[model samples]
Target: MITDGAAMGRKSVGKEYPSHGSVLGGKPNRCVIHPLQSSMVAEALERRNKDWIVRTKDATDLIVQVGDFSFHLHKLAMVSKSGYLRRLAFAERSGEENGSSLKIILEDLPGGTKSFELVVSFCYGGKIDVTATNIAPLYCAATFLEMTEDLQQGNLISKTEAFLSYLMLSSWKDTFQILKSCESVSSWSKELLIVKRCSDAIAWKACIDPKAFATLEEDEAFCLTLLANSHGNLNVEESSEKWWFEDVSTLRIDHFVQVIESIKSRGMKSELVGSCIAHWTVKWFSRITSGFDNLTPKHLAQKLQRITIESLIKMLPMEKNSVSCNFLLHLLKLGLTKQINSEALSKLERRIAFMLEECSVQDLLVKNYGSKDTTYDVGIIIRVVKTYALFALKYSEPRVCIVGRLMDGYLPLIAKDTNLTVDDFKSLAEALPTNARYSDDNLYKAMDMYLLAHPNLTEEERTNVCGAMQYHRLSQDARQHVMKNDRLPLKIVREFMLLEQVKMARSITACESNDHPRTKTRTIMKVTKGLDRGCLTPKREISMIRKEVENMKMQLDQLQTCKVKLQRQVKRCIK
Candidate 1:
């Protein structure tokens, strides 16, 4: 945890070190080269088939085997710097004869042979160059060998720790490099707190404003081209708040979570944190194919993805709209596919439900690639809709209506999936409040589509599926389509006809009342008693009722004929 006092303390020490990118690659000043010493070690290690014979005044008595590479060196020099080597050098070897060359096999050396070579060079008084690339593993290797100041003055452990401290305090990119390099030496890094310290540094840098630092050079810039408002600074073009997103997202999950928690604890804005999380998640999606299932060793890949998704869900900011609703929906789908923890999964659902209005039809159409499941994931969305309904009062009317419209657009798409169950479809359609939609034309269209796709449905199933829609709210064109749609249940079609007749009867009576002042006065009295709903005044209601009555008389003459034709057509279709 990088506390405020610690972060401020680091600021003064940071100025003593040179700015980042001054000593790394892409500059005229490259890191120091110790070619002669490097060649000495490389030449000795290259002779794997033969005993390594060093061309030195003293005969080499020690054979150090690091992986496939072996080095011929003096035991005195090795034992002096490494506590592990000192303990091993004097350990009894039962099979070995006296005066024979002693060989030590180091299979578990951190940083592998490349990092061990630096340790060997350090032991031999050769210059050891520490850079962002090698600092992490080098530190781990030195620690593993126990090259501490207690054994020798100005030891590898102390020197590397100092460099790591400087890198963590001063440079943003170096901290990321150190954390990435720790992947190969995870255990050692964690033990040494290198991972935690690097994560803290990154979190601190992210929480602080980038304008405090000098303009970054092109080589050090995280995304120079993408940062339009950066003016050569660290702020990203997407948003100034997202300056650290690209860099931090490069970290693997474990280290990424550490930094995220650190940042969260610093009281950074939840929306900024959420945007960063979403950015990281989107990057992960782009790398993956169909899913983690496509990876070799299916079970392991799925388990890893499940763990990662659960961690991400657990780390999400609690504030609303912190993440985009689209990302949340996609994450929810992935969570279901991965079978993440129920608590984390429910958290995702609640967040998505809170912002359901922001989602689109495509966003909700989470396709089920499972062998036994329906073409679309109706269950998850149904769960989300139920959750939204629970909190419906907390939301405004327009937002609820927007979600209803979104569901309306969504239902038609899912209805095309023949395997979708009527129960699932009906549950989702009726999940919202009764007043969620001022119009039911879209719902009617969806119900019609479902009926068309599922011609084998029982009459009761079709009635149940279409029952959620209000027939009176259907537009004139939708009413006409409904009358002609033979896939509809005869019972539902008859009910629609009855409702249409009632509406027409009301219209005719109201229109007639418009012509007679006495009838209109009676209509006004009824309206004063709050008989009408949703902004309908006495005059408007009476006129609409009279007009509907006129229409009812005209349609009644044809209603019987239409009903008979629809009933015969529906029965034929069912047959």
Candidate 2:
């Protein structure tokens, strides 16, 4: 019996049991199959025995090396899992004609050792543990090895692709996840269709809810994590809410550019991109000025070298917000080196000209001036424009181009905004130094041309135009023309007439004083009526009030003179 036990153990040395069997005590019954137990048994046997594929590493076959680790893998097993290895194996096997195994080392695998390890391990053992730390490299190696969609080794290719599609690719459902994942993969996704597919998914998400991406705006971890590991511990609950102005450190320029282009292609609101870019650039500058701590890959000595400054500026997804100007300014600053070429200068000219032409300068001023952080934001813009203006002045041709763009855009785009509002005009009037960029005569000429081109405008349209003229501060000539002209909308003409009538009534009342109670009440009524329905200019309203007060002063002066005359008459009567 002892001899039989020893014999049985010897026979069972490398045998895989689907579960613990009855071999030790009695005749082995049919092994009860538990799916989980079977998997565990196979895994244990594959690791401990190392007998999945013959491990002799015969010089008669293929030798695979990864760094210091070397594997004496069989040609049949390696060639079966990877076409890349297959081609290398057979090509070397036949050509060398030496009876030695072909030794091939992998140097360019991402995740380096770990990446090669995952894919190489799969080729030998027919299975691998796909992990966050290893999935990125595993995907790269598997792709490089041409192990795609093949069922040759326990579906090795399928399993690797599954890891990429689910964990790596699917994680980009929101902006934060997309950014974080892209950071890990770096230039890998651009080599594959995964990132572009994810972008398409976001495009679909945008159609469902344009603001669905806004959640990413609030996530600081996604933006900061690449430089510092501090932002990594987000839980499922925290990641549920997911989401350019720019001082760009070129380290993450590829990822950042990819992200922005994705948003633009998906048709996200550009204002969101603008605000996010502003915040991101500030953070980047802080990290950079802090001695470039963890922001590695100093290859950025050639800033934006991969993409031209003008191309990048043109490519930036800009909304109609001032922060878009911030992005433009950053690109312009990068291009402001002393040795700027004309090609660069021309592209800069085209873009700066676009900024002056395509963007609503007057509208941007209105938005910026209305912003709560006007001093800081508007101040930054003023400095950026000043920089651009200095650049423009450097070349007389660019300067002319800049001026032409401003003039052309001012007429069709800014001055004649079909949706022009009183607030916008007021903003423009206030920002004359910032906006006009030309003589007042030119501004007035553009305004006149706009109105003339759209003559026979509807009553409401003309009223809005006239109200902007009346209510907001305008060029003196524009104000006078709108206030007094017969060719203007009749209702606008009546508004000024009513305002004048109201002013005269108030002046007469001030002369009469409170002693004339009826006149005082009547003048108040007229003043109230003229201000009704939002018609009169605010400046005109102030002028009416001042004239009334002035009329009272004149009346008081005349009365004092009359009293003096009366004193003279009384003296004569007494004589």
Candidate 3:
């Protein structure tokens, strides 16, 4: 019988097995080695003959052959903490088949050298399953190996994949993280391309910081344009909330103009152009208006003529009337005063003529006034024209002619027939008041009356007469004479009084109706008082009293009849 300690030693020795050393028969008293043990010993002896395998204190490096293939295993880390030697021994003893088919060659990797083959697999693999838990280890390994392709491939997957991609990409700190980790130029390019293609605002924001982009001119311009275009589609209030492009205020005007011109050159569709124009107008209205307003009339005319008629029309709908009319007046004024190129002046003239014909002065005013849709009142057109004429009259002779003609066609009617007389109209027309508060309809009416009063007037005569009338101040005596003769219509006066009475009655009724609760309370109190004072009970009380009196009277009447009969009998006996 073996002692327990001796049996335990034998079993412990049996359980532990070396990966390389032979376990075959050797010395029985020394340690009875099996046949497989002898084979392992022979392999170890052969491995010792080769200089490639290194045995160190921390780990072991071995080139092992299993089947046809060979693989390297670094021994700086333990192969198995629970002991692979024990499993190998058990497999040898049980004659069980080893699951591994590929030969694994163990080679020690020094601290400086990297296992780059692992990186290649990671990069080119059909599918990579990287999670947060494993990412740090993978990233460390990738970095140590200088795995540019793998890092870039990872970045591409992170950006292109669905929600997982976004989460991973956003998890990165900055562009440098991608740059440092990636090995290939193409991989780095892919990173940039992925960032550029990112549609999520948050993802894009994470990829490219505005400050970083600002250093690259091309990138900065691209980013600004992208942001501007994006902002254009957003509601004004929503865009204001983001204010993402607020830094764009620092861009020079020329840069901004270049951006705008580039966008325009792309052939903007109506909706896009409208949105862009709206955003531009809101962002730079005062600046654009002031700058454009400062340009010489000739310069403005040249610029205006260069633009397509369609573009000009689009601009018109977006601009304030004052700004639009000012631009138009500038072109017209330039055509009259400056010696501009004939072609340019001709275009301006054609555009102006087309606009006037299409947008008739009367029709525009009536349409705008009737709809109450315009920012400026309909009267602004008259003031704008008058201002243009006055300014033109001061500078050039042709302008005077143009002004005279305009007055003949439109202003004369405004002055003579409308409430604005020739003199009051002239004062307003010459002064060109900015606030055109007076009713334009009155001006139209006055002009109509004057035209009716003077029949068969030649066009030239009418022009001169209207121009002269602009200077003619009507005398107070004449105004009084006109007023005295123009008495209010009796029917109108009677109707006015009737309307006043009806309005007063309605007001009184409304006031009384509103006080109904209080009135009803007072009325109810009076009724209740009358009821309590026996006025309501008096009817019942009087009816009862009268019934009793009637009964008494009937009884007395019967007694009286009896006494009369007795007296009658007595009289008869005496007779």
Best by lDDT: 1
- Tell me the lDDT of candidate 2: 0.46
lDDT of 1 by residue, 108-128 (tens): 999988898778776765655
Error of 1 at 110 (Å): 0.8
Residue by residue across 282-379, what tens digits does model 2's lDDT show? 56546554776445455554343424444455555544443554355554544553234557655544554446534444423422223433222233
Of 1 and 3, the candidate ranking higher by TM-score: 1
* CA lDDT of each prediction against the hidden true structure: 0.72, 0.46, 0.34
What TM value does model 1 have?
Answer: 0.70
Q: How well is each residue in 99-121 modelled by candidate 3, as lDDT tens digits?
A: 32222332322111122222222
> What TM-score would every model get versus the actual structure?
0.70, 0.45, 0.22
Cα deviation at 65, candidate 1, in Å, is: 3.6
* Higher-scoring candidate on lDDT, 1 or 3: 1
